[model samples]
Target: MPKALKIAPPDDVLTMLEAGVAGDRVAFDGGSVQLIDAVERGHKVALHAIERNAPVRKFGFPIGRATRSIAAGEHVHVHNLQTALAGQHSYAFDTGANVVTPLPSTATFMGYRRADGRVGTRNEIWVLPTVGCVARTAERIARQAEARVAHLVDGVHAFAHPHGCSQLGHDLDGTRAILASLACHPNAAGAVIVGLGCEENQVAALLERIPQARRGSIRFLVAQASADEMAEGVALVEELARAAMAVRSPAGLDALVLGVKCGGSDGLSGLTANPLVGRMADHVTGAGGSAILTEIPEIFGAEHLLMARAASRATFDAIVTLVNGFKQHFIDHGEPVSENPSPGNIAGGITTLEEKSLGAVQKGGTSAVVDVIDYGVQVRARGLTVLEAPGNDAVSSTALAAAGATVILFTTGRGTPLGFPVPTVKIASNHDLAVRKPGWIDFDAGMVLDAGMDAADAALLQRIIAIASGEETAAERNGEREIAIWKRGVTL
Candidate 1:
């Protein structure tokens, strides 16, 4: 039976939420309680009045101190909980070491081992476009390739993105670097670099930049070239797919690059889902495997927590540099970082961006920050590394795979149907969503909150081992391949 039908939330909370502006009454404290002030989405309101200097609570934590006396049941949003006035305190790393014990025996996920010693959870050939102009052609080629060689790999997807041309300096360089990373992604057995002849980003330029070992496995095709003077890129992709499918074999556990991510979060996210994924990351890294945790915007308030676990000053500095860069990027555009938390997050009870970010960073667990790389930079080194990416779910997940993550563990609270071209296992942060979106979500880590549940960390670790060892993720089984790429500038 579907458990979602059974777990009903209090009608009062639901009513209050729907009522938005106009107040609603809820039975509480043996009487009906009335809301004094109505809150707009992405805004805030107080449940009760407080004296001057009193603290404002968000997500059950102190977001900021009241600047002055505030009336009860009044608005306690940006007016009271000031972002600048909020306390930005540091935390001690390894705080959960006492509770989370490492796995006893070494565990492994079945993966595709590459010639250069990288492990991939999915086996596919990505058709890379050197410029955005060729994305449509590349996508067509990928579709044709998948159709022609259905039995070759689990799936094939075109890395269709909005960047790779226009602008100058790091903007252009960033696109190229990211494209290089996608070509070298672990899930891809090989890649076909497609170009439209004349573009800022040329296929030959990429060949010169890519490492010799990576170039060995990649095939390139230009739309301008044809034996009959006709652009038959689809036929080219089919030929490449045949060659890629022929190079298939079992890659071991150590060869995997696990991408860790979370979205649609709530208070329970940090308490359950994030920690569970963290433990799994530790296990994968402990076995000499790689795991990626990105979304730089999401790591805003929690960078210090990660800094403390950094292996060295360089690694820590790298994390800091990325955070500062993102901060500056927003500031330069006159956008506040507080503008980040989505409307869904606000609806789910998250008040401030800091409060939301604190919970979001828990997905990385307690492993030492082994390395910090810029956007699209390949993670050659092992262990836990942070990639520079936006807070957007699909964009970050794509960045993670581009950085060489083989299998991905993505956690969500509000239930997102987002899946990657690679084998992305979606774990719901709460049971309510897990049961509701069974087709989109795989594991329910929400059981951690159930009464009498013993050591959720252990159960979660076991589930990770199972999923890595050939268990199909719900998203994979349902054929969900959601893709989105974050663009730097406005597209007119």
Candidate 2:
């Protein structure tokens, strides 16, 4: 039988588990409703008649207002509904209804310990270009050094980006901060600072921020100064490889910094993958580990849920600003605050930005907001830290990596082929996506719908620990590692 799921008590629509045509019956908790219009799997169906311009409720919140009158059992989607959000609104800090608790510890993983006492899941040498001009040189250096260090390190790679030059103010400063933070990442035991001879992002300025203890392992090269850039680059890379070459030792899981993100989401995302990832967040935080959650825009509608779990009133205030400030970012551009949940998301049963946000925030897993940090800054909090960043996958992933995420858990329903510099484990929301994109998906949470969250949670934990202990994700195996900086300011 094709059944329907009502996520929350106040939900006015049901998400169909399987596709059904007109006259088809969808059974729920008590009675069954015959379909008045066809609905595809992972799409919505109205539970009752909704008048034109009335709020269309899903997940216990109004996703949007009906464009036209909607009959009971009719398919609810983009054609009949539209985003209700217009602009940003003032938010009040409210954290009264919450229980105070402490993060418990119980697990460990094998990792490399840096001189400054930070732990890393991978012991690889990284190459960073001050500008895009030296990107190829950096990659060439990494490719050559990768072969030499194959028997010693996890992997060697160069991060390439388009910016670092032809910018001013915060834009240029952002590039500098992100690159510097990546240079300081615990995962990279050593790094080569590649300069394009005259780029605004100078190696001297970059090197000034790197910890003095790790300076001996870092190398700086100016393309114009060297007679043979390739030779010079490779020589520097070789030095980095030699310094970074080390074996993984048993480290407490508390030392791990995990990044949580979701993209290409569907209705099942909240029902399965995101919640399971949240459970993983609780587990990690409970174990004294850190988990960073970004994509500020996606968490807009559900901002209150996290605010309620904030560790302090100051944290709640910061979160309110984080939410409102992002909303204003859209209004400043003359766009609607809830103008999101891409076409793929709409096809996957998301009607409005709020609907998408409600599902997207499930990845944070009911953890308290310990701190809030801006983009390009290394995270200092140990629990669930909210980062200020756009919802773009590459940009957000790179930001998380810069914030010192050793491993990133990326949940997707429509699926993504991209990966960040760090090991990215893609968790599929549906079993079909997992089956179709085996090379892209590392874990499938669809089984939760059939098996249960606890069982899926255990399986996911096992896979995460395995990856932390030196296992390669699908992204790493396919060599899809990349970086993207959020370019907010003008190019000039």
Best by TM-score: 2
The CA lDDT at 434 in model 1 is 82
Residue 197 lDDT in candidate 2: 83
Tens-digit lDDT track for model 2 on 1-492? 346663545777888877888998887655567899888878888878899999888767778899999988899888898887766656666654653454575778898888877899898889999999989888998898888777767888899989888888888888998998998899988888889888888888878777688788788899999898888888888877776678889887688888999999987787789889988888887777889999998887778778888889899888888889888888888887777889898788778887888888778877678999988899897888999899999999999999999999999989998989888999999888999999999999988887788799889988988998899999998999899998988876
lDDT of 1 by residue, 161-189 (tens): 66666646666676677777777776777
TM-scores for the candidates: 0.80, 0.96
Q: Which window of ten consecutive residues has the lowest lDDT sum in model 2?
A: 94-103
- Note the Cα lDDT for every prediction shown: 0.66, 0.85
| Clash statistics: count for each candidate | 7, 2
Best by lDDT: 2
The reply for model 1, stretches above 4 Å from the true place, is: 1-52, 56-61, 66-105, 227-253, 451-463, 466-472, 482-486, 489-492
